[model samples]
Target chain A: MAEPILQVRGLSTYFFADEGVVRAVDGASFDLYPGRTLGIVGESGCGKSVTARSILRIVERPGRIVGGEILLRRHSGQVVDLVTLPSDGSAMRQIRGGEIGLVFQEPMSSLSAFHTVGVQLIEAIRLHSPLSKKAARARAIELLALVGIPRPAHRIDAYSFELSGGLRQRVMVALALAAEPHVLIADEPTTALDVTTQAQILELIARLQRERDLAVILITHDMGVIAEMADDVVVMYLGREVEKGPVDAIFHAPRHPYTQSLLRSIPSVLAEPRARLATISGSIPHPLARPAGCPFHPRCPDAMPGRCDADVPVEVSFADNHVTACHLYTEPVA
Target chain B: MTTPVLEVPVLEVRGLRKHFPIRQGLLGRVTGQIRAVDDVSFSIAHGETLSLVGESGCGKTTTSRCILRAIAPTSGKILFRDEHGDAIDVAGLDRKGLRPLRRRMQMIFQDPFSSLNPRMTIAEIIGEPLLVQGMRDTRERETRVADLLRLVRLPAAYLNRFPHAFSGGQRQRIGIARALALNPSLIVADEPVSALDVSVQAQIVNLMLDLQDQLGLTYLFVAHDLSVVKHVSHRVAVMYAGRIVETAPTKQLFTSPKHPYTEALLSAVPVPDPRRRAHRIVLEGDVADPSNPPPGCHFHPRCKYATEQCRTEVPALTEIEPGHAVSCLRAAELSLRGVASGS
Candidate 1:
C-alpha cells in the first residue's frame, strides 16, 4: 500500500461544559491514503464530526484537543503534528484550507448569506494562491464548473439563498476544492439532500477524489453511503471507534455487535418487503452521563455483564485490517 | 405475508388538487397557481400501508395534508370510511361536518422534537386527544393514557415526565400514542422516522407495523426515504412535480418498476452491501418547479428514457399491470431497472 498522507493516532477531543466534560472524540485512530476514501460512520453524538473538527484544529470554544497526534506528511516529506500547533496560529491556518478542505452538512448555515457565492469562492481561492480579484474570480468560476454547477459564470453572482439545496451543495464542493487541497473532509455532505440529489453529489465526490487523488474523510450516519463510497470504514459509538476495517470486511463480516446490529436494523430497499427489522435495544446515552467501559453495552445484545461494563475493551485484530473494540473479541483477563 | 380479504378502502382520494396562488406586485395580484398537489389519487385499504414517495416539493407532504384536511384541497374528493362503514367525502364536508371525521383520521408529524409540547407531561400529551373528544373524566383519561403508553411499549411510569426527558425515538413513540389516542382508523404519517437515528428508526418502524397488525389501522405513509418506504409500505405511489408518476405494490415497485422516474428513484437508494455497488442512474437536473413545470411530462427534463412525444404530450396515469400504474409515455416499452429483491 502507498504511504498514508494523514495518520490520526489516539485522537481525543473534549468539550468542557458547566456539568462535565464531554469526551467527544475519544481515542480515535485512522489512516488516510491519497486517492482512498475513509468513511467515519456513526449515529448523532457519536463524535464523528468532532473528530473531523479536531483534525482541522477548528474545535469550537469550550472544546479542546486534549491528546493524540494528527500526523500530516507535507509535499516536502516533512511530517508535522497538527495537535501541538496553536489552532489560530498562521501555520495551522495555512494547513486548514491550504492542505485540508472542509464541507459542512448545512450549506445554508456554513455559507454567508450576505455575500454572493463568487465572493466566498474567490476569497478562499485567493487565500491559498497569490491571485488578484479578477484572476481569483476566474478561478472561482472554474471551481464551480469543476463541481458540475451549470453556467458557473452566471450562478457565481447569485446569493446562497437564491440557489437550490443541490446547487448550494455544488457551490460548497466548489469552494472546498478551490484551494486544491490534498484531503477533503465532508461531514454529512449529502444528508440534507434528497435521494436523487444525494446520488449526484456522491458521484461528484467520487469523481473528484479520482481526478485529484484526494484523501477524503467522509463522515456520515448512513451505512448505505459508507458501503457505496468508502474504501475503509470506521464505526463509532459514543465518541469511541467500535470497529474499523475494509468496507467489504466491515459489511460482510462485522465484528462489533453495534455494527452488526446497525447493519441489520437499517431498512434496506433490497430487503424482503414488510419484513420486521432487527433493532438495537436502547437509544444512545446522553453525552454527559456516558456509560462506563463500553458505551454501547446497554444496547448491545452480545454485551457481557462484567467484562463489557466494568472494564473497557481494547481493539482486537481479527484479520489483516479488520479490528473491533469489544469484550466479545478481547481476551478475558485473569 | 397473507393478503387480507378485499374490503372498502378506509380512505380514497380521487383527483385531489391543491394549488397555492402565486401573487405578484404591490397589489398582490394573483399571477398563477403553484399546483402543490395536482390530480393525485390513491386508496388505502384497511390495515394496509400506502406510502407516497417523492422528493421535497414533489407534493407528497401536500397530498398527505390534503388527505388529513389539515389543508383544504382546491378540488376533488377525499372519501374516508366511517366506523359505520359509509364512505364520507371529507373534502366536501364543512368545518362542523369534518369535526367527527377528524378524530377518525389523525396525522403524525415529522419532527418529534417540535411536534411535542415541552411543558406538557406525557400523560397530558397523550390525553389531549381524548380530552378534545369529550373525555371529561380525568381518571378515565389517565387510564386511557396509560393504556396508550403501554401500547407504544413505553413504561406507564414515564407519564409524568415531559418531552425533554425522552430521546427522539421515545418522543416519536409518544407522538404515535397520541395519534392513536382517538383510535383513528387512518393515520397520515409524514416522514415520522426520517428525523430519527438508523437504529431508532427500525424500532419505530417495527412498532408501527405491530400497531397496524393489532389495531387494523390504515396508514397513508408519506416520506422521502425509499428504503424505509419499501420496508413499511404495502403499496407505494411515486410523485414528481405535484403529480403521481407511478403506483404499485411494494414488491413490484422494488423488483420491476415501469416508470423511468421510479426506476431512477429505486436505483438512487444506496444499497447497504458494498458488494452490490452498481452503476446508479444520476438524474441530470433538479425536481421541476411546481409553479412552472414542463409542458408535458414533468419528469421529461431529467428522465433518461424521455422522447420527443414525452416532451410534447401529457401522459395520463394508466394501468398496464393489475395493481400497478404508471404515467410515462413509454411505460410499456421501457424496460426500466429496479433493485433486486431480498436482503
Candidate 2:
C-alpha cells in the first residue's frame, strides 16, 4: 500500500492511580490508510479507547501518554507529530474536531441534554471557523442531512432527547462529520443501538468513506462488527496488541491464540444449535497485577514453559501483512 | 403433537396482557394505558428452550415478569404443571396459595451484580431458597449449596465469599445456582448472558444447556440478540409492539421466516463472515409507542411490505407450516429472503 494517512508507533499511555501505575496502553502500533477502516478489538479494560484518546490527546485526568509518535501525513504532503502538540493548544484543538472527528458509543451522554442538537452541532462548527451564526446553523443542517436524518432543517432544532436512539446516534454522526475531516475515529458507535439501527449506522459509515475517501479507525469488541466494517484488524489483549493483519487473514486464518479464541467464542449466526464454544481459561488479569513476560501466558494453550515467562515477545511477521507476538512461534512446539 | 405428549408441558401462557395505567394531574386520573404485554400465547415443552427475542420495548421482560407473578398481570393464564401432573393456573392463584407452586418455578435475572446481595455470602444467597421453604438443617443446606456450586462449575471454596469477590461470569453462576436450589422444572432467564463479554457469554450458554440436559429443566430465555438465540433455543418467538409476530422452530424460522418483522430482524444481524456482507432491511422509523399504537398494525408505519389493507386491519397469528406461525397479511404471497443455512 502507499504511504498511510496516519501512523501510530509505540504509543504507551499509563494512569497514575492510587493502587499503582496502570499501563493502560503499552507499546501499541498500527497504520490507517485512506478510505480503509482499521478496527481495534478488545474487551473492557484492554485500553482500545485509551489508544484512540491518545491520538487526540484527550486522555482524562491521571492518564498521560509517556511515549510514542502519532504521525499524520497532512494533505500538503508534510508529516505532523501529534505527540509534541500541547494538550489544550490551539493547533491541537483544530486537529481534534477539525482534522480528526471522533464519535463515542453513547450519544445520549456525549451530547448535552440541556442544549438543542442544533446548537451543539453549530458550536462545533463555529469553534474553529470564522463563520457567522446563521452560516454555521446552515452547515449544521447540511451535516444532519448528510448523515441521513430526515428533514434536517426541522430536526435540527430538536433537543437530543426528542430523537430516538437511532436518530440520536445519527445526529452524533452528523456532529462528527460537521467538519470535513480526513480521518474518522468511531469508538463502539453502534453498541448502544438495536441491531437494525447498528446496520444502518455501519452502512452510513461505509458510504461516507466512499464519498469522502476518509481513513477510519473503528473500535469495537464484537468480532462480527470488525469483520463487516474493517479492512485491517488489531486484536488487543491486556493493553497490548497481540495480532494485527488483513481482515481476511485475521478472520479466515488467525495466528494469535486470543484472536482464535475470540472468534470461536462468539455464538456466530453460522454456529449449530447446542454446539459448544471454546473459552479462554481465565478472565483478563487485573490491571494492577499485569503479568510478566507475555500478558496472555496464563491462558494461552500454546505457551512455552520457561521461555514464555522469561522475556517479552516481540512481533514476528509470518506473511506479508500478518504479524503476531507469541513465544510458541519462536520456540518450536515441544 | 400426535402422541398426545405423555407428560404435561412445563409451562404454558395464553392471551397474557398487562396494561399499566398512565396517571396524571391532581386527581391522578388514568389518561391512557401502556399495553406492556398484549395478547401473547405460547407453550414450552418438557425439556425445550424457547427464546423470546425482540427489541427492548417489545414486552419480553413484561411477559417474563407476569409469568413469575412479580407484579400481578392484568389478565391471562399461566398454566404451570405441578409434580402431580396437575395444571395450575398460576395467574389466578393467591399469594398464600401460590407459595407451594413457587418452589417448582424459578427466575434467573439479567443483571448479575444487582441480582445478588453484596452483604450475603454465596452460601447464604444460594441456600436462602431452601431455607425459605422450611429447611431447618443448616448442615444439609450447606451441603446443597456445595452441590449447586459444583453444578455451575464454581469452586465449593467460594461458599463463604461475598458477591463482590466474584467476576461477572462467576456472579452469574451464583445467580444460576440460586435459581436452581429448589430444582424448579421451569426457569425464566431474561437476557442471562447479555451483560457478559463474548467469551463469558459462551461459557454461561454452555452451562445453561448442560444444566438443562442434566436436570430436564425447561427455559424461557428472553433476549434481544438473535444470534445468541439461534445457538441455544429450540424455538424462537419474535415479538413486536406487545404481540408475538412469529413462532417457529429456530432453524426453520431463521432460514425461511414468514413474518416481515422476523425477516428484517434476521437481515439486520451482522454475519460474522467477511465474505457475506448481508443486504440489510433497515426499518425506516422507531418502534411505535405502546400507549397509542397505530390503528391497525403497530409496525405498518415502518414495514416495507405494508399495504392499504394492513393499515386498516390487524393481522391475527396464523399457522403456515407444521410449527411455523406468522402474523402478517402478506405472509401467503411475500417471498421474503432468509440467511442460507450452515456455517
Candidate 3:
C-alpha cells in the first residue's frame, strides 16, 4: 500500500470566548492514505468539522489551531507542515483548494446565486492553472459532464438557483473536482438530499475518488453514511477522539462504551419492525460545560467510576488496526 | 410479529387532494392547479401508528394538515372516529361543528422551538389545550398540567419556566405534553423528532412509543426517515408525488416490498454497518413536479423498469396480500429487494 498522503499529529484547536477557552479539538491525530476515505463521526459540537477547517487553516473567528503538525506530501514527494504556513500566504492558498478540494452539505454556502455555474467552475480552474478563458470554459464543461450533469454545456450557463438540490450538489462536485485536487474533504455532502438523490451523490463521490485517486476526509454525524463511505473511522465526543479503527471493526466490535451505545441507539433500517431502540442515558452536554476526564464519562453506559472521570484513558489497540481510548479496554483483546 | 390489532380506525383519509391554485394577471385569475396531495388515502387504526413516509414536497405534511384542517383541502373526505365509534366527516364540517372535533384530534408540530409560545410558561402552554376543550376550573387545569408534565417524564417543577429555558428535546416533550392535554384520541405528529440530535431523537421516539402504549393513542406519524418510521410505526405508507404508492404492515413492507420505488428508497438508505452495504438501486432524475407530473406513473421518469405502457398507464393501489397494498404496473411480476436480513 502507498504511504499516507496527509498526517495530523497532536492537533489542538481552541475557541477563545469571553467566558472561557473552548477546546474544540484537543490532541487529535489521524492519517489519510491516498484513495482511501477517513470518516470523522460525532454528534453536534464534537469538533469534527473544526478539525477539517484547521487543516486548511480556515478556522473561523475566535477559533484558532493552537498547536499541531498537518503534514501533506506533495506530488513531488516533498512534505510540508500546513499548520505552520501563513493563513493567507501563497503556499496556504495553493494548498487550500489546489491540492485539497472541499465539498460542503449546502452547495449555496459555497456557490453564489449571482453567477452562472460555468462562471464559478472557470474561476476555480483558472486559479490553479494558467488557462485562458475559452480553454477554462471548455475544462469547466468537461468537469460538469464528468460529474454526470446532463447537457452540461447548457446547464453550465444556468444560474445555481435554477438548479434542483440534487443538481446543485452535482455542480458542487464538479466545482470541487475542477482543480483535480489530490485530497477531497466532504462534510455531509448528502445530508440535505433525498434518499434517491443521496445515493446518486454517494455513487458520484465513489466514482470520482477512483477516477482521481483522491484521499477523502468525510465529516458527518450519521453513522450510516460513515459506514457506507469510510474505510477508516474516527469516533469523537466532546472534542476528543474516543475510538479510531477500521470501518468493519468500529461497526461490529467497537471497544469504547460510547461507540457501542451509539450503534445501539440508532434505529437501523434493516432491523425488525417496531423494535425498541436502545438510547444513550443523557443528551450531549453543553459545550462550555463539557464533562471532565474522558469527556463521555457521564453518558458512557459501561463507565468505570473513578477511572473514567479521573483522567482520559490512554490509547490501546483492541485488534488489528483498531485502537480506542476507553477505560474498559486497557489491554489488547485476544 | 403478532400484536394487538384494533377493530376500528381512529382516522381514515379517502381520496384526499389539496390543490393550490396558481394565479396570474392583475385580477388573480386561476391559471393552473398544483395537486400537492392528490388522491391520497390511508387509515390509522386505534392505538396504532401509521407513518406517512416520503421525500420533501411529497405531500406528507399537506395530508396531515388536511386532517387537522390547518388549510382547506380542495377535495376529499377526512373521517375521524371518536371514542363512541362515531365517524365524523371532518372535511365536510362547518367551523362551529369542526371546533368540537378539534378536541379529539390534536397535532404535534415538527419544530419545538417555534411551536411553543415564548411568552407562556410550561403550565400555560400545556394547559391551554385543556382550556380550549372547555375545562373551566383553574385548579382543575393546574392539576391536569402537572399530570401531563409527569406523564411526559418531565419534572413538575419545570412548569413555571418558559420555553427558552429548555433544550430541543425538552421543548419537544412540552409540545407532546400539550398535544396529549386534550385527551385526543388521534395525534398527528409531523416529523416530531427530526429537529433533535440523534441521541435526543432516540429518547423522543421511545417516549412517543411508550405514550402510545399507555394512553392507547392513535398517531398519524409523518416523517422522511424510513428507519425511524420502522421503529415507531405499525404500518407504513410510502408516498411519492402526492400519491400513496405503497401501504403495508411495517414488517411486510420492509421484508418484501412490492413497489420498485419502495425498493429504491430502502436501498438508498446507508446501512449503519459496512458489512451490510447492499447494491443500491438508485432512481435516476429528480422527483416529479406536482404541477406537471409525468403522464402516467409519476415515478416512471426515473424507474428502470419503465416501458411504453408504464409511461401512459397509471397503476391503481391494489392489495396483493392481507394488510399490504402497492401501486405499480409490475407489482406482481417484479421481485424487488428489501433489507430483510439486516444486510
Candidate 4:
C-alpha cells in the first residue's frame, strides 16, 4: 500500500461541563490512505463525531483537543503537522475544505433553507477553487451529477426545502467534493435517510471513492453501512477505541466484549422468527460516571474479576490487521 | 393461533383520508387539499400487532393519528369495537361522543420525553389520563399508577419523581405506563423505540412484547425501522406517498413481498452480517411530496422496474397469495429484496 494521506496518533479531546470533565475522544489513532474507506462505529455518546470534528479543529469551545498528532501530506510532498499549524495559517486554510471536506448528517441544518442550492454549491466551489460564477455553477451541476442527482441543471436552482432528503444529501456531497478533497468526513450521512436512499448514497460514495481515490471516513452507528462501504472498522466505547480491524475480521471475530455484544444485539434479517435477539443488557454508561478500569466491563458479559475491573487494558494486536483493547484477549490465543 | 385473543378486530379502518387545505387568502379560501393520507385501509385484530412502516413524511403517523381520532379524517370509516363488542364509527363521532371512545383507543407518541408532561410527576402523568375518565380518589389512582409503573418494570418508588429524573428508556417505560393507564383495548405506538439506544431499544421491544402477552392488548405500531417492525408486528403495512402499497402477514411480507416499493424497502435494510452480501434494490430518488404525489403510482418515479403501465395507472391492493395483499401492476413478475418471490 502507498503512504497514508493522513495519520492520526494518540488523539484525545475532552469537554469541561458544569458536572465534570467529559473525556469525549481519548487516544484515537488511525491511518487513512487514498481511496480507502474507514468506518468509526459506536453508539450516540461514543465520540465518533467528535473525533471527526477534532481532525478539522472544529471542536467547539469548552471542548479542547488536549493531545494528539494530525499529520497531513501535501500535494507538493510537504509533510505538515496539522495540530501544530496556526489556526490562521495559509496552508491550513487551503486544507480545511480544500484537502479535507465534510458531509454532515442533517442537510437542512447544514444547508441554508432560504438560499437556492445552486448558490450554496457555487459559493462552496468558489471558496476553494478560483472560478467565475458561470464556471462554478457549471461545476456544481457536474458535481451534483457525480452524486447521481437527475436533472441537475434545473434542480440546482431549487431550494433545500424543495429538494428531497436524498437530493439535499447529494447536494451536500457535491459541496464536499467541490474542491475534490483528498479526504471526506461523512458523519451519519444516511442515518436520517430511508433505507432505499441510504443504500443509494452508500453505493454512490463507494463508486466515487473508486473513481476519484478519495479517502473517506464514514462515522455512523449502523453496522450494515459499515459492512457495505468500509474497508476497515474502528469500534469506540466510552470515548475510547475498543476494537479496530478489517470489516470482515471485526464482524466475524470481534475480540472486544463490547464489539461482540453490539453485533449480537442487532436483530439479523436472516435470523429465525422464534429466536430472541441477544441484547446487551444496560445502557451506555454516562460520560461522567464511566466505570473504572475497562470502560465496557460493566456491560461486558465475559468481564474477568480484577483484570477488567481495576486497570485500563492496553490495545493489544491479535492479528496483522486486528487490534482490541480487552483484558480477556490480552493473552496469546492458541 | 392461540384462539385469536379478541375474536373481533379491535380497530378496522377503510379508505381513511386526511386532506389539509392549502389556503392562500385573508378569507382562508381553500385552494387544494394536501393529501397527507390519501386512501389507507387496515385492521388490527384483537391482541394483534400491526405495524405501519414507511419513510418520513409517508403519512404513517397521520394514519395512526386518524385511527386514534386524535386528528379527524376527511373521509372513510374507522370502526373501533370495544371488548364488549360495542362498535363505534370514530369518524362520525363529535367531541361529546368521542370522549367515551378515547378510553378504548389510546396513543403512544414517538418521543417519550416530550410525550410526557415534564411538569407533572410520573405518578400524576400516568394517573391523570385515568383520572380524566373519572377514576378519581388519589389513593386508588396512586395504587393503579404504582401497578402500571411495575408493569413497565420501573420501581413504584420512582413514581414521585419527574420525567427528567429518569433516563430515555425509563421515560419511554413511563410513557408506556401512561398509555396503558386507560387499559385501552388498542394502542397506537408511534415510533416508540426509535429514539432509544440500540441495546435499550431491544429491552423496550421485549418489554412491549411481554406487555402484549400479559394484557392481551392490540397494538398499531408505527415506525420506519423494518427490523423492529418485523420483530414486533404480526401483520405489516408498507405505506408510500400517503397510501399503503402493501399489507400482509409479518412472515409472508418478509418472505415474499409482492410490491416493488415493499421489495425496495426490504432490500434497502442492511442485514447485520459480514458473510452475506445483499444486492439492495436502491431506489433512485427520495419519497415524492405528499402534497402533490405523482399522477398514477406515487413510487413510479423512483422505482427501477416501473413500466408505462405503472406510470399511468394506480394499482389497487389485490390478494396475490393467502394473507398477502400488494399494490403493484407487476407484482407477479417482480422479485422482492429479502424474501423469495414465491412462498
Highest DockQ model number: 1
- Interface RMSD values for all candidates: 0.9, 2.2, 1.5, 3.4
Q: Give the Cα error of residue B221 in candidate 2, in Å.
A: 0.2
Mark the 10 consecutive residues where model 3 chain B has the least summed lDDT.
B1-10
Error of 2 at B301 (Å): 2.2
Write the residue-wise lDDT of candidate 4 on B192-297 in tens digits: 9888877788788888888988998889999998888867878889999899999988777887778888878888888766565577676776688887789789
**Candidate 3 residue-wise lDDT, B1-343, digit = tens:** 4455777778888999999999999999999988899999888887888999999889999999999998888889898886689998888887888888888888888899999999999999998888877898999999999999999999999999999989888999999999999889889999998788788888999899889888888899999999899889889999999999999999888889999899899999998989877698877889989988998999998998888999999999999998899999999899888887444
For residues A160-179, what per-residue lDDT tens digits would candidate 4 score against the true structure?
99888888888888889898
Looking at candidate 1, what is the lDDT of residue A160? 99
- Complex DockQ, candidate 4: 0.50
State every prediction's TM-score relative to the real structure: 0.98, 0.97, 0.97, 0.96
Once superposed on the true structure, which residue ranges of model 4 sit more than 4 Å away at CA? A332-334, B1-6, B25-27, B333-337, B340-343
Which ten-residue region of model 1 chain B has the weakest summed lDDT? B1-10
Tens digit per residue, CA lDDT, model 2, A1-334: 7779899999999999998999999999999999999999988788999999999899998999999999988756789999999989987888888889898999999999999999999999988688999999999989999999999999999999899899999988888878778889999999988887898899999999999998999999888899889999999988999999999999899988888888888886666655667777767778878889998888788888887777788887876578888865664333
Each model's Cα RMSD: 1.5, 2.2, 1.7, 2.2
In angstroms, the error of model 3 at A262 is 0.2
Q: List candidate 3 stretches off by more than 4 Å.
A: A331-334, B2-4, B25-27, B341-343
Positional deviation of residue B336's Cα in model 3 after best superposition, in angstroms? 1.3
lDDT of each: 0.92, 0.88, 0.90, 0.86
Q: Which portions of model 1 miss their true places by more than 4 Å?
A: A332-334
